[model samples]
Target: MPGRSHSGGVIRRLAPLALMPAGAFAVHQLRYWLAFAGRTGLLLQQQGHAYLHSVVPWIVLLAAIAVGVFLQALGRAFGGQCSLPRQTVSFGALWLICAASLVAIYIAQEFLEGLFVTGHPAGLAGIFGYGGWWSIPAAAAVGLVLAVSFHGAHRVLHAVADRRARPAVRVRGPARARAPRHVPAPALAPLADGWSGRGPPR
Candidate 1:
């Protein structure tokens, strides 16, 4: 029971913590951009492409792995058994969250750029351009798909685990029903002996 309870708690806690890597990666990217703004114009002009391509991806990858290890440790702590499928799901969810969060940040950056750099008129159109409005529906569709897929996968995992455990339960049932070695069995033993013609004297 404790194992089951602990596994449930682990799932609950790890699900939310799954978002941490993406969030941290985003913050790191933001910090890099901010620091870039402080560089000399010559350095900025020369190193912009290098910084984006080489440094950013590695930082994001490391952050993602760090978050993954943390979640795995939490899973182990709570007695949750990890398998390949479960790890895949966890990593898939992490990447999905990271992609979505980055898109959201980009959208925000678009609005900020328009307001501060382009001096756009403030309104709904400024927040999201007329064409950019489509992102809302696109994001909604993506979220729905991810949610349904995750729900189906979770159900399948539970079903498979239940099926695998069923055989063990069946195997243990007869063992439990077996008469205990320490239990006195005079009544049944005599019945067995009487049938076999080796019963005790009257």
Candidate 2:
């Protein structure tokens, strides 16, 4: 149906935009899972258990992924029309923006964790204390990965678009074999000697 085909086309166009975000989310979840399984010190504690039991971590994670999707969509909007050097610069800027955004999100997550899990608001001084500087480099690294992911996704989308835009080739079936024409063999050269039925002139 027309509607189905149209929807499929739309999905095809939009799917690549989410690739980077989806990958980011997967990596984030994997890290969390591994940390949880290995009894790592990464998971923070609130009362007597890990703060992950609260809903805030999941909410923050989803929010981060949403931010990622928005960034990827933004890249999709401008990255394709520009030249390679321009794209490189723009994506580099995007990386810096993502790093800054991550830092902000980290601060917010810390604040929210305190408010909901510890029942007190976290002071900015405490949030940006000595160990906080680690966030900057971590976020920068994450952003760089995301920037590369967005570029890869763009390439995939371009390839798909090119493939879809190409004209279709028609393939024909093989030709049928024809029968040979009959020529009657020139009546066998009149029997070579005109042999009569009267016993060959006895």
Candidate 3:
């Protein structure tokens, strides 16, 4: 055991990957709560909040990861690194997609709330429209943050994968050539005198 150590524990190493998304989700929800506490308090208190909470946020996270991968792909397309213009374009595309998706999801949720639940989030109706200028921008902001988060997650996952694939022992120097073994010469019976093939013994 002298020259040996191992990253034997599987779950321990992967703890970061599992924890990162949870942490990001917590921060995302907390940020929203803090920002909208004054106005959207009643909407947040509604029973249908469960339906909204369970589904939409996860969709946002999926979008973020997809956007991040797209951005990374753009980066690779340009000189194996992300150019500033390409990054800007990717972020812009992400923002558009994110903002539109949020508004659309909110509208659909509101429609469903109207149908099933009692009073709907009438306030959220103006989200990204007239009174709620902050709606799209806010969603885009979250998208950006989550994009960066998932990008980091992507990197961490890849690094873990690489680490797993790599050989445990790293040899620094060239492998030593095996020395030839000193095997003894094979024994043989003694030859009789004049034992030639062409002539018999005199």
TM-scores, all models, native as reference: 0.35, 0.46, 0.38
- Candidates 2 and 3 compared: the better one by TM-score is 2
Q: Write down the RMSD of candidate 2 (Cα, Å).
A: 9.7
Instruction: State the weakest 10-residue window (summed lDDT) of model 1.
Output: 43-52
| Ranking according to TM-score, highest score first | 2, 3, 1
Candidate 2: Cα lDDT at 145: 76
lDDT by residue (1-202, candidate 1, tens digit) is 9999777556554553444434433443443344444553443334232333465566567556545654564444344343323434554574466447645754675566456543443455543443445444444444444445445545554555545545444334444466757967556664565565565679
Residue lDDT tens for model 3, 1-202: 5323223223223332432333334433444455576655454555344554675676567556545555454444333332112123354565455445554554554456556775444444523232334444555665566556544544544454455556679669988999999999775534544353465659
Stretches of model 2 off by over 4 angstroms after superposition: 1-43, 46-49, 53-89, 119-121, 168-202
User: Best-fitting candidate, measured by TM-score?
Assistant: 2
- List the pairs of residues colliding in candidate 3: none
lDDT (Cα atoms) of all candidates against the true structure: 0.48, 0.52, 0.47
**Candidate 2, position 53, lDDT:** 47
List candidate 1 stretches off by more than 4 Å: 1-122, 168-202
